[model samples]
Target: MSNIVKAKIIEKIQGFYEAVDDNNNKFTVKLRGTLKKTNDKLNCVIGDIVQIDVEDNVIIGIEKRNNLLLRPLISNVDYVAFVCSIKDPDFDIINLYKNLLWVDRENINTILILNKIDLVDDKELEDILKLLSQKLKHIKVIAISIKKNIGIDKLKEYIENKNIVLSGVSGVGKSILVNKLLDIEELEVGEISKKTKKGKNTTINTRYLEKNKIKIYDTPGYSAVAIPDYTDKKEIMTWFPEFKNYLSLCKFRDCLHIKEPSCIIKFKVSEGEIDKDRYEFYKTLVENKGI
Candidate 1:
């Protein structure tokens, strides 16, 4: 009889992959050639649930995935923690919208983190909360200062027992915060360059770490974000939760909300009902994609 065990792919280092079973046993595994017969795509990524045919403590097969992320190569993400800084690679609302759009396109839930709040004044932090509240109605934004150890407990409580993907622009102190959350000191923290005002790519690959029943996959900070393609430009509007109320009120059956006569979305923006910035962002996305 063969030793067949099931586990979740935690991380890959060098050539061997690490997996954690239900019993908390860690196994270092390698792929089996028989995997090629069933699935042509044998590549495995972090956060994948796999079955291992262990003979002498090695991986012999990889099971199919529930879902997969192309760039970072992560799968089965329950939540995405979008970590944004208040300063030092300053917070850009447009970029936040871009990140939200991509996350929504993937049909994944998000938790926006306003990190480094210790660097900002109360008023500045309050303003950020207000702005995020207005534009991101569906998403929840948590303000945290890993340096001061503020709001860490709240964030931890929210992520309890969930698989989270920590993502953001460089220089936002994501790794540092994650290390603090896990009570580990080894994860490298990237510094913001004085000349470029950008963060170094310290995290080269996806890393999986678990703490207090919560699992997190920290991905490399993305400088340039690409929104997912849509077959119909009108479909993009549905991703914005705030637009749903007015979508049915539009005069045309298929309204992209741009240059369409009696467009309820445009009217809402004009009347200060909808966020102008988000509306503008959507318009620009539609125009740039030419969908």
Candidate 2:
């Protein structure tokens, strides 16, 4: 038996994978023809470090993933680029929360990108941004217009030297930002329906882009968010970094904070200690995520 050679799969399409061997040599190998991929886990995403068995220059094994995106089916993500738009598609706050949830759930840090900034004048967009600034703190928010190529450097710097996963609702400009980031002029763009102004979801699978040691995984855009599995509403509360401390003071151990007495979470919400929209949305997520 020969020693199993390892390869990092950078992209997969139509049963063939573009992988880089340990020596940084890239090859397009068929999954079944080159390696016996058992398809073990459902959570495997791009950017994953995989172990491959090779004999006589043929790959054989695709070990496992550190983490993966459920819908796009990629793994080993390092960071998440959560994009929202100021116009064209507009911002959906609820979807924002889900993107935040997805990143935090996987322990991936996030960088918030506000796209289509050129659509609105500074004065017109100021208020919405001020509101967002108040609600979301501690995370980096970069405003950019892919059309004008403005603010592309900030996005370029953010994902540079790292593996990033792009996530957002359809028509919010996820793909636009991706194209601008790579500057490849070859990435696919999604079309939005005129009636609903929502993206047509061009990306069917997770795809990878790499340059200068930076890797990006672009996920298929969705029109809305499907809440992840969370046991208690309070368990979901822990996801909010700003609310973590106040949670200890809640009177009841199982406080949903909707109508509970001596509820610290509610008090904070009332006192502006917590973002009210987040608290309300947390309740909303509970209803949806719960079976």
Candidate 3:
């Protein structure tokens, strides 16, 4: 008789998957030929729980995922740590907001990590924090410095025993932070380009690592984040939590908040109740049909 057991996919390379069972027994499994033939759009990815045939070392079935992210192509993510550096590559609020929109659409829990705080002075850091607080009050922000070993413990506490993915543009210190968290210098750290002041791509593949029972998926840094195609332009407003209260107060029942008469959202922007930059960014996303 053939035995089958449940396992979680930790990594995928070439055509094989590295999975670990409940007992921590590791197996290098391949997709069953029948499974491949049937499902044309196979969605198998890291963090997906699957059933494997022990005898054949083949993935037989994939369990239903709670959530999935397309960019890193991971399933069942509990938290996404969007890392941004204050210097080196420089902080780009627009990019951060764009990533947050993607995460909000997926209904995933997100934490904004401002890395490289050591490079910025106290007043500059305070002002940035203030700006973020006003614009992104719904999300939690943690400022960390890898060089000075600041806020690492606090960050670890927030993600303890949870499945997390470190995502950011290349050169934002995601790999370096991972090394610190895992207490090993395993992943390569890339340097920022002196001319462009942008991070060079370092992590090319997503890999899973465990530290004190904390599950982490370190993903490749993206220079440009791609929005999900499934995102409905009409529902873009729903992704912006700051617009929630004023949305219901709008004149039209289905107000897109653009050129609409007596729009509460627009009025709030004029009153300085909403961040103008954030509102403008929202308008851009909606006007472009979420492109």
Clashing pairs in 3: none
Q: How far is candidate 1 from the true structure (C-alpha RMSD, Å)?
A: 4.2
Off by over 4 Å in 3: 32-42, 186-201, 230-232, 245-249, 271-273, 289-291
Tens-digit lDDT track for model 2 on 1-291? 645556777776665567776467776655444334376443222455555544433445556666665545566776777778888787776677776776666555677788888899988778877887778764677888887888888778767877787877767767656665666563333333442344243676777776665677777766666666665555776667667777778888787667779998888888996888887777776655441
Ranking by TM-score: 3, 1, 2
When superposed on Cα atoms, how far off is each prediction in RMSD? 4.2, 4.7, 3.8
TM-score of each: 0.81, 0.78, 0.85
Q: What are the runs in model 1 whose C-alpha is more than 4 Å off?
A: 12-17, 28-44, 56-71, 186-201, 245-249, 271-273, 289-291
- Pairs with backbone N, CA or C atoms under 3 Å apart (clashes), candidate 1: 30-59
For model 2, how many clashes?
A: 6
In candidate 1, what are the lDDT values of residues 192-222, reduced to their tens digit? 2342234343676777888678678888788
C-alpha local distance difference test of each model: 0.79, 0.68, 0.83
Cα lDDT tens digits, model 3, 197-246, are: 44333566888888686678888767776655645566888878888777
